[model samples]
Target: MENENKIKLFLVDDDALFLKSLEIEFMENADFTIETFATGELCIAQLSNNPDIIILDYQLDGIDQTAMNGIETLDKIKAFNPNIPVVMLSSQDKIEVAVNCMHHKAFDYVVKSETAFMRLQKIISAIFEYRKMKKELNWYMDRM
Candidate 1:
């Protein structure tokens, strides 16, 4: 049975092949409900769907120049809902890029690699656990 409690995730990348691969990989896990978007704008437009997390590509090649890159999109997402966790993915492994993403409140910056999927899965699990703990703590605090 599909779990209604599964975390909803938005995967935004301009690379069709990469997006499909991610969708397939994430779909293997029952804990995630994945939604794919080809551009940051499309993803942002659907923020009303209220995904629990977002995996956004740092470089949106072939997309319109006006379209937001990962950092810009991340800023918009945070402005819209700071609580929603965003993970930035990029082929570029520059420390500066990773720092920029962190500065914009990215939950994590992942370099695209053969191990990227495994790393992302682990991060997702950690995020969920952390959120659950925070919720429980808040509940206890409210009662106290």
Candidate 2:
């Protein structure tokens, strides 16, 4: 598939192994322009590239002691472009963390586990489908 036609994804995580694994899975399974970032700061810096979806890690301080956590990154991404879908990924299974991410306008939250890749795929599909529906509805509304 052409690069323009493929979905663009930003995968942000401090864990090198997990990040590589996720990247490989997406590359093997889907037509996606995938970019991996070891830090939220790098992801934020590339917001202008306009990724269709971002899977960000909740704890980004694994390498850097003072790096912005997932919530902060989510907020920044939202501030830059509220329409970009961001899925928060974390090892933490705490409800509060997920709730906090949702409260900050995250598209969704996925706990980092064996099923994370599958869950992310589903969520990404849903995001695109929802956007398509919204656009169609707007088009119909405009005709009326």
Candidate 3:
């Protein structure tokens, strides 16, 4: 059996080009094993406990055989496992969307543009840091 330290990542987006490009970039430069889906429903189907982090596009196509969006998808994920880190991506720098995602416990939000390349690295680092802190906290709690 593999340990929890593998650090898998899943990306749910509708953009085909970005999906291909991101897979290439991460495979070339990052330590994470990446799985991607073109729609939220597809992502949900491929879901596993191994993915420590998820990147959610703010808008998604069909889910549940109905129109589904990222906010709703985020809610579904929270219901599944609130501890898994979710990073929201938006086409525009919408503060309201950011606030809503943060309220629902999204790890971070990144604008889907020039800033995306930069934010991806930062968010991945933050997720690893958060996991480390959480492990330390759990260890302390266990000993107490």
Candidate 4:
């Protein structure tokens, strides 16, 4: 169950250990209501739930080979709802892949490292702040 005020987040990854670690790290924060998915297709199925953000793994190996990769999944997500911010995560630091993700409208691309969790936290916080400011500005404009 999620509190009405908490930001909803969907994290999709095929690596169980990594997914669990991320879940644990984000769970420490009360501001987020996080949901984990083992596949991109599964995450896409839940898009109607309207998460504020999605953190998706770039490579969905260990699952079926037919499973959509991050870029394909991102395309589906954007088609479904372009407003949802998606953060693409990769263990490999490939410049081409990162650029492609950005070209496809990824909110950010984070390479998996010891500092990945910290970087993710910062990105999420910045997104929340930006959304808050946008909402506040919209409200003010509506009154004019």
Query: Model 1, 32: alpha-carbon shift in Å?
Result: 2.2
Q: Which scores higher on lDDT, 1 or 4?
A: 4
* Per-residue lDDT of 42 in model 3: 71
For model 4, what is the error of residue 58's alpha carbon versus the real structure, in angstroms, after optimal superposition? 0.6
Let me know the TM-score candidate 3 reaches against the reference structure. Answer: 0.86
Task: Look at candidate 4 and give me any clashing residue pairs.
Answer: none
- The local lDDT score (0 to 100) that residue 105 gets in candidate 2 is 94
- TM-scores of the candidates are 0.92, 0.97, 0.86, 0.91
Task: Give the top-scoring candidate (TM-score).
Answer: 2
Q: Give the TM-score of candidate 4.
A: 0.91
Q: Across residues 59-94, which tens digit of lDDT does each residue of candidate 1 receive?
A: 886567777788888999999999999999999999
Candidate 3 residue lDDT tens string, 29-138: 77767889877777777666457889998877633345568888788888888888899988868899899889988989988886686788888897788788989999
Residue 140 lDDT (model 4) = 100
lDDT of 2 by residue, 38-96 (tens): 99999999999999999999999999989999889999999999989999999999999
The 10-residue segment of model 4 with minimum total lDDT is 25-34
Q: Is candidate 2 or candidate 3 better by TM-score?
A: 2
